[model samples]
Target: MHVEPVRSGAQKKEFIYLPRQLYRNSPWVPPLWMEEQNGYGRGKNAVLSDNEYELFIARRAGKAVGRILVYIDRAWNDHFQSSDGLFGALDAEDSEDTFNALIQAARLWLEKRGMNRIVGRFTRWRSSGGF
Candidate 1:
């Protein structure tokens, strides 16, 4: 499997919707659809718009199997004087390889941005408790 940054509109949709497929027949409580869309919109979410962030999708055999969002909250870091990075909205298939690939991608991105510590599951909005 390979991980790619979510770039195109279709990939964004897939990133947002992959959890539905992954959690089908389970007790997952999905976030409101419009809220999810707005959260990812370029200027809709203050948290996302004011931070440095990227969304990624993992694909295997041309099918999406996992997704993640990595971000650096510069304002938070500046306030706390921390070199930390955060990741959230994690959804993945039950495959170790897929999980590793997705996490490594996030790690590398954060490292490139000078983050020394990694904090996670910083989910902003969701109907379910958390990731």
Candidate 2:
């Protein structure tokens, strides 16, 4: 397994595609918003428009198997009085290799930002907020 953080606009789009590719058969998974991604990747997302974020792609045996987005939302921090970092858009194969890659990328992103606490679909608004 290998992890490569995507740093360019074009490469970020590639990272976005990884999830759609993995879950094409999941009917419950709604279609992704490409426009949103373009905006977020290009730093146009209003909420975190000024914050720094990264998209990561994980590969196993030279094949893309997972993806994750790690973001540092400055506004969230200022508003909450905490380092409320976010991990989102996580998708992966069932295998441990795929799971580890996504998490490793997310961990690095948070660790670099001095974020002692983090949130994700596993324990945050990103996955269970919708009603």
Candidate 3:
């Protein structure tokens, strides 16, 4: 599996649809498609407009299999005096390799930003629930 940063609408769409596809027959109920799309948009996601963040999609054989979102909240860091990165909205196939690739991609991005610690759920979630 290989990981790539989500840089376009197409990538965002793929990232948004991953969980729905992966959990089609499971009990997970995904948030509305538009809501998922808006959550990734700078115009709609105000937190993103003010924070440093990136979304990564993991793929195997050219198909999206996982995704992870990593962000550094400068305001939160300044208030706490902590060099930490927050990762969330994680979703992946059952494969260990897919999970590893998603995590490594997030780690590399955080490391590049000088983050010393990562804190938060790496589970799949739109709000407080997970897949």
Candidate 2 has its poorest 10 consecutive residues by lDDT at: 122-131
Q: Order candidates by TM-score, high to low.
A: 1, 3, 2
For residue 125, model 3's alpha carbon misses the true position, in angstroms, by 12
Worst 10 residues of 1 by lDDT: 122-131
Where does candidate 2 stray beyond 4 Å? 8-10, 28-33, 36-39, 122-131
User: Each model's TM-score, in the order given?
Assistant: 0.89, 0.78, 0.88
Give the winner by lDDT.
1
Identify the leading candidate in terms of TM-score: 1
lDDT of residue 55 for candidate 1: 97
Candidate with better TM-score, 1 vs 2: 1
Off by over 4 Å in 3: 122-131
Query: What is the lDDT, from 0 to 100, of the residue 35 in candidate 3?
Result: 82
List, residue by residue over 13-113, the lDDT tens digit for candidate 3: 88888899888889997788878878885778776888989999998999898998989989879989999899888889899998888888888899999
